[model samples]
Target: MTLSLTELAACFEGVIPSILCTVGADGTPNISYLSHVTRLDDEHVGLSDQFFSKTARNIRENPRAALLVVNPHDGAQYRLDLQYCETVGSGPVFERMAADLRATSAQVGMTDVMRLRGVAIHRVLGLRAVRSPLAAAPPEAWRGSALPRMAAVVDAFADRTELGEIVDAALDALEAAFRHGATMILLHDPARDCFVTLGSRGYGRTGIGADVLPGEGLIGLSGKEGRAIRVSDASRLRRFGAAVEASSEQENRTRSVALPSLPGAMSQIALPMATQGRIRGVLFLESPKRLAFSAEDEAALALIARQLAAAIALSEADAAEAAPDAPIPRRPSEVASPHIRVVHHAHDDSVFIEHDYLIKGVPGRILIHMLEAFLSAGQVDFSNREIRTDRALRLPGLKDNLETRLLLLRRRLEDKNAPIRLLRLSRGRIRLHVAGYPIVISDRKSGAQ
Candidate 1:
């Protein structure tokens, strides 16, 4: 396989890292992705192998090989088959590769949970570079065909959206985003001063949905410190609390590359979610791979986080607009003081709602927040007030008709297997029948041990 020098150079600049593969003696080929590839001076091209495998061994024995690079987005993948005369490894090179590998894994959410032994290499053979569709090639082909994947996540803010539909779509998209391993949405509860795992994707057998407190584990520290944390090993991190009894809960919460240990959390970027110039919450991404998050990936994720913050703010505004308005319910002068919280026990959980303040495409935003607020505050009996009804009438679409909305809210609460009913009163009062979960106060602690 051969390519014009120009085409070969273009491949080097594409989105997907060029992979160096090696075959074990028996023919089991070990191929992994790479992030760095460059020509040492002018003759040899150097590549990193933080994702240590048998690629080096295979290259050492056969000297015949292939290189693959592709666009990360929806672009065509490209391959190069060539020969390498020698293979090499240096202490610094190994260290650098390992670092890059860990960073890349963190950004994309890949956790191998394997012992990373070391990094190796493949020395390029004679000057016979190759490219795709190689037969007829201009020694100097112009660049354009295969380029690096460029993706930017935008948090769209708008006045109103079809919330139920958008949430349904977003949930599906979120699942796809975390198809590889444990993907979660870490929401900031200013009241609690901690981050909670609201949604999870691809979790392992053990229950990971449990909460974590700030400075309690790896995730917690990131939330508390408001910065990214990296660990090279997990067993040694003192911050990881005692072992959980759950069978799936490993003694070592995360493989260490830095310091703290959070369950299923290693090499994480605790990107804070903020809007209106304030840090409202955080987005904690964990990868079992050491140094999982890369610079480019971090940049992308940071941008996504910014978009998320904007989206949440927009969703909140939209939600406000949707609140009952046909007949404005008398605003209750007394909402149980934000500081007072008590747990009323029922055989079920509290009302669960996703209130992204800024995501515009989601319709029925404001009404939902109010529903959530009522549900969140339900356990404390509203004393037969007319707040709920009055507010429903005031809302635009409700026409003071909160029966349907309440019914839907009730259905959702029941679907979650919650035994408690957060009841609404005459105007806009809300209360709960069974024990309620402790309302998160801005100053309270959050998450599991």
Candidate 2:
């Protein structure tokens, strides 16, 4: 039988949570509550265990394993079984797994419930589902180590694809994310200051996505606030009604198409892509399932949102490089902030980078990047040198010209007013001269506009 699992897993967007059966060193197999088993790309699955445990030790001994999951429904007897021949436990692999579990779980109404149990990561293996006798009769017809055919649809995303290519891939991923059967991605049109659905899938004869007003829908909230927002019980919410766009005839068209019935998009997620502290566009994922966005799901989508930002940045950079007339903007000592919108809640600590005193905007941004580079070098070295204008060349044209930018950059550095002056522009070379206490720039990446 088709089992729905994921601790309160969003019926549509919920992350299918599970416990993996692993053979320990003594050859005894055991299981534990796995808060982390999530999709990494389409072909692979990841496992996340908190601290070190028998399950982790089992994976360390032998990577072969099967993750078990039982939903709250299905008479408490049914579960969705995912057979993973491979596993990745520690390092960054668990990052996605842990995040997905948290988001999906949270969406299910259990916030802060995903505890990794502090299991030390043992091994990460690549898995292939071991087919069972009940591989037929549709995915819902059977369970126990069963992987649906649609899992193939997940393989569309890649870490390294052009932004244009990724846009298409993103639309597909969005459909999977929402499981709205099919979905569309609308980018915030900066020129028009409006939202427009750019791509879609899984519909016939009509598509949705007319230009929407700012701060109106989930997509609007994402672009306006620069955070990923998921909406549940869309119909019940007074703010949202039914979509007005039409679906397309092409089942796998590049542009978005409306689903036959909007596939019960009870929950939706909108992620705004940004980089280097600049907002790029929006990635809207709609789900047919109510309560689809679990906390783990939200976290997973947030990571994907970040990944999307990087992908978009890299892709656009590639495109700009390819075009003769289009100039890709890059200056020296420039660091990016993923270009997504940031929440401006007032906290005691500052999120923006600095060198003690308040340094705002790009001028402040450059100095911080420099401080980072120098401090990382160990030992404050620049001393006994006069300031010069050529420092502007280091980060081309934050000012009017190389000469003027240097003057601006140097003045900010001098104003720090610390025990010793670490940075001094001497001759054509910029210097970082400090007497004692190696000056290290704070951990921040602020920008202006």
Per-candidate TM equals: 0.39, 0.36
Task: Give the per-residue lDDT of model 2 (tens digit) for 16-134.
Answer: 33556668778897867654444443334445546256755676676666654433223122223344354445456655444444444444434356445332332223322234454
Q: After superposing candidate 1 on the true structure, give the runs of residues whose Cα lies further than 4 Å from its correct spot.
A: 1-180, 205-209, 230-242, 246-267, 327-416, 419-449
lDDT per residue for candidate 1 within 359-410, as digits (tens), equals 1101122223343455554324332123333453234332222322333343
Lowest-sum lDDT 10-residue window in model 1: 354-363
Clashes of 2: 60
- Give me the runs in candidate 2 sitting further than 4 Å from their true place: 1-162, 174-180, 205-209, 238-263, 324-449
lDDT, candidates in the order shown:
0.41, 0.44
Give me the overall lDDT of model 1.
Answer: 0.41
**Model 1 error, position 399 (Å):** 26
Reference-based lDDT, residue 343, model 1: 25
